[model samples]
Target: MEKVFNTRSMIFTLYGDYISHYGNVIWIGSLIRLLKEFGHNEQSVRAAISRMNKQGWVQSEKKGNKSYYSLTDRGRARMDEASKRIYKLESKAWDGIWRMLIYTIPEEKRHLRDELRQELIWSGFGLLSTSCWITPNPMEQQIHDLINKYDVASYVTFFQAKYEGMSDHHSLVNKCWDLDEINARYTQFIEEYSQEYKLDKQKIANGDMSDGSCFVKRSLLVHQYRKFLFIDPSLPKELLPGKWIGDAAADLFTDYYHILEKPATRFFESVFEN
Candidate 1:
């Protein structure tokens, strides 16, 4: 089956997984060449990068009539955070406290409210109710940043407290998020990538896979795993079910990533530095 993609998102994946490692910059022509492997044409690449530049994720430079793009400070920060999360092999230990955020944005500022909700979810916050979000992770700094970003201090309240309810923490987790659904997605990823990984490993051993092909496979691997960032909360080990598949998936992703990493970087540098 063919994969349906968003050009802009694919650009983000390239920047995060490949470009950042190579001086965090790329010439427009090289980027266009790299993206062509995925069926994205020059026009699509130009349009996507233009939109990203306008969105403050990248800045353009003119170097002797050639255009180059590099991540802005905001974009680098996001990529750094995403890289850390993407490669995390295990969940952090929990302190047995939940951080809860409740917001009451006025009707006039509904747009900010909507954006904040997405940010919350991306930060691993689970919805407990209409306007209340909860997470077992430490998010004081993230909460402060969110409030400052949206300028909604007056409409939001934050709390860190232990749950002393009649039901267990597991029940609370169930109330906020669907663990089973998330597990199913992880299972699918494992099934899909595990086979590819074994096949690629053999191909690389036999000198059958080209460096350019390795680059494409590695990009797709990271892109696929990155989707879990939106759906998996990366909850503490204590909060997860007994038979969680996320850890197994993480292992597979890490192994596969390493198998593709050297040749992939070689391919990327050949295009980027030429």
Candidate 2:
């Protein structure tokens, strides 16, 4: 099957990976040039960025007849969070306590409920029941951010408590998330990227890879790995399965990213600086 990328999502990846490091701003023309490496055209890039501006993820400035875009505070916060997760060395030790959230928002506020669910999932909260979400990680700040962002302080309740149920804690985990499925995804990422990493590393060493090619490969690599955020709750070692492949995937991603990093940045700056 042919791969397809959402233009807006690719913009988010680019901003998080590249533009954010370079003053968090890029001329619209320069942004279009960088995205062109991924087969995104000018019109699509323009439209996607316009939508982001409207959604408060970015804001635009006019430089004479030229336009530039920069991350808004919300955008910077999200990018900071994503970068931390993406490059994390390890999950912290579990404290033997699960953080839980339950909500009772009225049906009339279904939109807020839906959006809140998505944010919770993105922050590693797995659905335990129709109205309950659970995680084993420390998430006090994330919980506070979600409540404030959604203005659902009255509708939501958060807790930090040990699981004293008849079933073991692992059973509670199984009820909330599919560890087997997440492991399978990690396996796939390892299989595909391992081979690509070997090939690209050899190419770079042989001086056969161009900066532009490296830039494209690196961006795609980060984009693919970033999908794990939605599926993998980044459970601590104690909560994970006996033989998880996520660590292997993380290692491969980090090593492969290092191989592509310098050249990719060169290419990005070549476009972004002009």
Candidate 3:
């Protein structure tokens, strides 16, 4: 299997485990155990711990060779936000129906099978058995929409609730993303960037527009765009307005992208490649 590391997902996974099993005091051994369960090797787990600690989400104290760790208040706040996002995405009332599904695509359609399975997993579905999927939440409509969107209606069959208490790994995984930290970092970035560009309302409103150039606007737009991208792209259109505060936020995002997109891309590329 190809390994993927999404910062949001990884952070959620770590903190979610802390909240669930350790009540925040996650010892080194416990963290190692959990990481092993998630298919991480010893080195990777150590690196993750170091990186998170450096980023201020976790604090660790070393007693001899043993390290004990716990979330900082900032980390705790991030965990709380991640939990809320998970609940919003998955805690819909159970309709007393499982909405199980199975696909019977031809052998040549094996690629489709993988795609469908991934889609189901992303939508918070659980694998019950070979070719069978279920969810604790009543998301029959979502399943139906996916089936139609993927053109798999012919190769798939749906059934009503046959099983209960299906475990949702997505919610569990999402809890680790450290949303509070992510939000905090972004908030700090916006504030500093705004000040650096002299776009602070008091500054800009008081004839300081000399420094309020396109750079400030571009920075703000990029941050906002990244924020919206964290949510599901397929969410109902009505949920996000096209404009905010008498500005076409989407259009501004586009303009910002044109200005900073290449340079920003290069900056991240250099960091990651190094």
Best by lDDT: 2
Task: Rate residue 171 of model 2 by lDDT.
Answer: 91
Off by over 4 Å in 1: 1-4
Candidates in descending lDDT order: 2, 1, 3
**Model 3 per-residue lDDT tens digits across residues 152-269:** 8998988875433254533432342333444455455445444443333344456453322323243334334444334332222222233222123333334434544444333322
Return the TM-score for each candidate structure: 0.96, 0.97, 0.33
Clashes of each: 0, 0, 9
Candidate 3 positional error at 240, Å:
7.1
Residue range with the least summed lDDT across 10 consecutive positions in model 1: 1-10
lDDT of 3: 0.51
TM-score, structure 1 vs. true: 0.96
How many clashes would you count in candidate 1? 0
RMSD of each: 1.5, 1.5, 17.8
User: What are the Cα lDDT values of the candidates?
Assistant: 0.91, 0.91, 0.51
Roughly what TM-score does model 2 have, to 2 decimal places?
A: 0.97
